[model samples]
Target: MSANIENFPGTPLSQADFDEGKILTTHWKPKLEYGWDAGVAISRYLAELKNGRLIGIKCNRCRRTVVPPRVVCEWCWEPMEAWVYLEDTGTVNTFSICYIRWDATRAKEPQIPAVIEIDGASRGAGILHLLDEVNADDVTIGMKVQAVWKPAEERSGSITDIKYFRPT
Candidate 1:
């Protein structure tokens, strides 16, 4: 059996059609729901955060430890060997002082965000998080800092469990 195909030109609607309610339309409100799995590495990492500890994955091949752990070593392309608990201390590798909130509203005080190189991890492996408890001008590369965790009862298994990093 053969099927027939045809191309048809569209007829433009006129103002009279709209006025007469000839066009058909309906309102719709969709409900969207979903769940996310952080996978093996990140799940363990986040769990450790809630416990007030930092964890990293160690790659035996490259002898590199990475924070916010990954299942594979980025440098050697090998499977990570084991989990390593790291000190909550780190050094500020780089930073920014923003006067605007994440929503783009003006902020009363500047938000200082920085990439902190975990002391026990590889030289450059770091996490991006906010810095607090010090003047914006006082923040600098190589500044020693420590994670200020939320009270144990207030912690949830998330990065926010570590309230922020502050100069030690």
Candidate 2:
């Protein structure tokens, strides 16, 4: 198939006419700084996670409990009622067996990623995390799992507080 290629109007450089010594290339190292506010819900959620506890919020209007405790309910558009403690053990709603790492690198074994529906949380209130301590072929929907948290002292007030989820 013939293809029409849009070439930038420029004099083409040929091997015979191009000289390595005539071209100047400078290397640049980029430096950047960034920060963000976690906001009320996420900040409290992270703090609770750092302390080895899971907390969520209840919406009176919608009659639903949500994880990562939000100040306002997404469904009913009202302020959430109160905070609620949640169990670490949960069920895997959906999952994927991946053969690549987050950094675009390959892996010898497949990694299992799943959406865990925390016990005592509302429907559709699942958290995304990796699965461990099980074979890739054994992972299935509705599988029971529990959070394997890092030591409290080593907790960094982030989702990484939980090392990974393992079968119960």
Candidate 3:
């Protein structure tokens, strides 16, 4: 939708007034949703995490397991048919050391968000997480890591189920 002042209701607001509205909305709530497919997978994953397991679904056609599980094969476009247990340990596919914190949800310390290629999964298939217990200078592609989970009482159905990753 267009945000032009001329299309706004009633009198046109000045640039300063429009800027004021933008500033106010800067902290507005983010959009949230729970579609049918996502809900089922999330419920299952969370239950598995509570039992100290990392769960993912495997595509019947491609024989590739996907973490945070997908309802279908991303590569072959076929329904994922089986459940698989993934090793928390994986090689870092790509990573970035951030000197600046982009979101308040992260730790006060600088974080390195990485795309980790989990063991036994298809090439390039990966999960993103913050890398911990290492200095920024030591961070490198292909570094192995293991998931550090949150306390059982603090577990949730989201990525936050794992607190972070540490050197393996």
Candidate 4:
């Protein structure tokens, strides 16, 4: 049997031709910046992180503890006010193995990121953070983990304050 391969869309260029600049191409990088207000809850949350502590808010209506504390509870549409300290340790709720870097470059080793359900927070509440100091293949749901915070002086009231989570 014969195949018809000519009814394609646009022109196709070989890797060598593209790499050699045989094809006309223009690219430009955009300078972008972003600013965010942590607001009452999150600002306090990040601030506590800088002080080597974790905190959460409770939704009085649903009685669910919220992590990365928010100003309002989405569950009951009620204003969240009760604040509580959370444990640095938690369980991995879910995860991903990143084979590419943020810049889209191939990575030699995978980056493991997971939503860790903090021990003192609601059962399903978690914050997304990276994992390190362990092989990627060893990561598993429900795996116990703990935050590895940066040095106190290096903290800047940001999520990155906790460098990463590692198996406990």
Which is the leading candidate under TM-score?
4
Please list all clashing residue pairs in model 1, or write none if there are none.
none
lDDT of each: 0.92, 0.90, 0.79, 0.92
Q: Model 2, stretches more than 4 Å misplaced?
A: 1-32
RMSD per prediction, one decimal?
Answer: 8.0, 4.6, 6.6, 3.6
Native-to-model Cα distance after best TM-score fit, residue 41 in candidate 3, in Å: 2.3
lDDT of 3: 0.79
Better structure of 1 and 4 per TM-score: 4
Error (Å) of candidate 4 at residue 144 is 0.9
Task: Please write out the lDDT profile of model 3 over residues 47-164, one tens digit for every residue.
Answer: 8877667888888877778887867776898877698888878898888877665553545667789998888676778988889888988988988889998887777656787788
- Candidate 3 root-mean-square deviation in Å: 6.6
List residue ranges in candidate 4 displaced over 4 A.
Answer: 1-28
The 10-residue segment with the lowest total lDDT in model 2: 16-25
lDDT of 2 by residue, 51-107 (tens): 998899999888899887889997899998689999998999999999898898998
